[model samples]
Target: MGNVKKKKIALGLQLLIALFLGGAAGFFLPQFASFYQFLGQAFIRLISMLIIPLVLPLVVVAVAEVLGKNHFQKLLGKTFLYFFAVTTGITALFVFASYYLGFGQGVNIGQEGASLEGIATGVKIDEFFLNFIPSNLFKALTDGALLPILIFAIFLGYGVGQLEQEKKEAFLSGTKIWIAAIYKILDAVILLSPVGVFGFIAKDVATTGVDKLLGLGQFVLGMYLGYGVLALVIFPVIAILYKVNYVKLFKSIGDLVTLAFVSGGSSVVLPPLLKRLKKEGYDEAVTDFVVPLGYSFNLEGAAVYFALATVFLANAYGITFTPQALLFTVLLLSLIGKTAATIPSGAIVVLLAAAPQLGLPVEGVALILSVDFFANAGRTALNVVGQALAVAVLDSKKEKTEKVEKPAKAENVTGKELIANAG
Candidate 1:
């Protein structure tokens, strides 16, 4: 009972403190809003810096571990199959929901709702496939080509797997230590989230007022609600079916989501999220690989946002959506967008690219840019939660397979338990 009360108090403190700091930023620095903007930008930059090195080591370490052990390829094949299926399923769910809920349906918001913008308008599938392979890795970097970065990460992980076992283990172990240290720094960064969340939220609300929210309100509302339902309802149901109850499951990771929200960047939230999933009965191996992989490839919020935003743009421009056209748009985004990696400007770039592909307007992004930062906080929170959930599903399937081979149970206990057990 005392512990429960303590948890409640701690949570309350976080919420109140975040609110206070956010509100205080507005009052204290009334004239210099740019300073607050820098504060948010700096926090996001730190998260961005941390994510790349974070992913490299995790991918390298995880690949070494998975490949050196038993039936690694089979496990990986099955995991990817499930991961892709789940990612697509989540994407499909939102696309359908957007259409069903009829959001941004009647609104006329974008100037060229029907323009192909700068795209070639129509391209052959084979040509697009050919484009996926980077013509120049250097050029891709300068050009912000996300698909190439992802292909590079996969190749690097696989190459790391070809090394000798002992050497690989040493490398993995060293990388693991560095990852742990990075996570510790992540925790310290998270400790600052409440202050950061408040600043961003309060400032966004103050400037936009409620009017902007009302203007593109349908799309904005859809983005948040879709994620909320998926994260709270759909994800929890998926967990329970996997034999993990959603209540404890969601509660287990609540702190991390809240932390991610405050931090305004999901990458900063990744380390703690991976840890929480393990504590909640997911495997470290699966979480390590899937979370990093999912961050790059499977973004639930971005997927939903893309759908709603396109619909909003199309509607705002008085462009009608044919059933066939909407289906094609959903299909392309699920395939291309899901494979895209996590980065600071990824969603923006993708959305800009998407406009021409879907025959929507590019200026739609400019119209939404101000709201992106605000909306993306919620996006990161949900996307990170979804990544953790995906790993939970993968972990469940593994548990099923292991049990079929032999009975299984919590094989060990450590941390505070080991100390108590030692005494």
Candidate 2:
């Protein structure tokens, strides 16, 4: 345990250094941009390589664990509601703030590096929803489409839940072992993250240069300001209502937040997050259920960025969103924006995907792509925080329900009140 804690601290320091070193290399060493870019892509690919083996079985096991318990449907409903409500509310705030601030009004990105075909826009809403059905399960798994994989895992886990008790235990036991092996592999991959962070930032800096950053300053500031409102203002209100110790909660998960910011992907942070949830006294079952799905679904931070990007992009092109278009964008983001995690530069892909529907220029993607590493740091931190918040809130709800039930269970067992009533 002591060694593990020491390693975490060491890793955190390494990641911080990588962030600074990558930025310096990018800013001062533009000639070697390709080299840094290679390192960054290599790191992303290494982690991506682990996704199929790690994510698939982990989702199956988590869903199976949830299904085998009582009130499975109830738990799912409540948690999903909490995720949607918080995400929707915060997204509205982002849109309102960006619109009022007029972030992208005068900014214009050069077309030198902008390639509309290279962007992943023009995906229709019908097609987006249809793909969720997954015509080929193997293809979906190989392609690393998380929503389809999740769908497959849910069905398989439900099947496992219906098995005979002995067989169910055996299956679950085997699944746990499988997941542990994958985690061991991920442990090896995690050590390379600092190198990855350095490369990613350096490459972007070398290629994008200072001009893009200066031009997009307001959008970037507005993006961070939105996150600030969500983190400082909104999260605390929810925490207070849920009776959570907000300061303690943030401190406990600070390392995970740093990991997400540096890695720029929340999927990689799940193992440590689960460990923290357990250490912090949340139920193991709830931890298993909430954290995995929440990683894929509860991306409130990314949603905020996407919302701000939409308004920012519209303003950049001197376009305006009709009231109907604006409402549609918010609703779409609240529902499908989180699906961006299924692809590379997920937050950006989400923006591109919604570009057609929202009437924003597809080329605006290039503008955001240049600064994605910095933007992703903030968004990814929020993703980690959002998941942790879900666990805290839901776990608190569970405790309250249990507390309310304990007296009834005692009353039934003791029967002294029944005897007194009879007399």
Candidate 2, clashing residue pairs? none
- What number of clashing residue pairs does each candidate have, in the order they appear? 3, 0
lDDT of 2 at 66: 76
- Model 1 scores worst on lDDT over the 10 consecutive residues at 112-121
> Candidate 2 lDDT, tens digit per residue, 1-423?
556643245777788888899989988988999899789778777777776676567667766777776667877898889888888888877776677678678876554545556656655668777876778999997777777777787788778888898998898898889878877777787788888889877877788766657866777887888889878988889999988878788988886688677667776676667767877767766777787778777888888888888888888888877667667778987766766773336788788778766766677776677777778878888888888888899875657456445655573555764443232
User: Candidate 1 lDDT (Cα, whole model)?
Assistant: 0.65
TM-score of 2: 0.84
Tell me the TM-score of each prediction against the true structure: 0.78, 0.84
Candidate 2 ranges with C-alpha deviation above 4 Å: 1-9, 106-113, 321-325, 342-344, 396-423
**Best by the TM-score measure:** 2
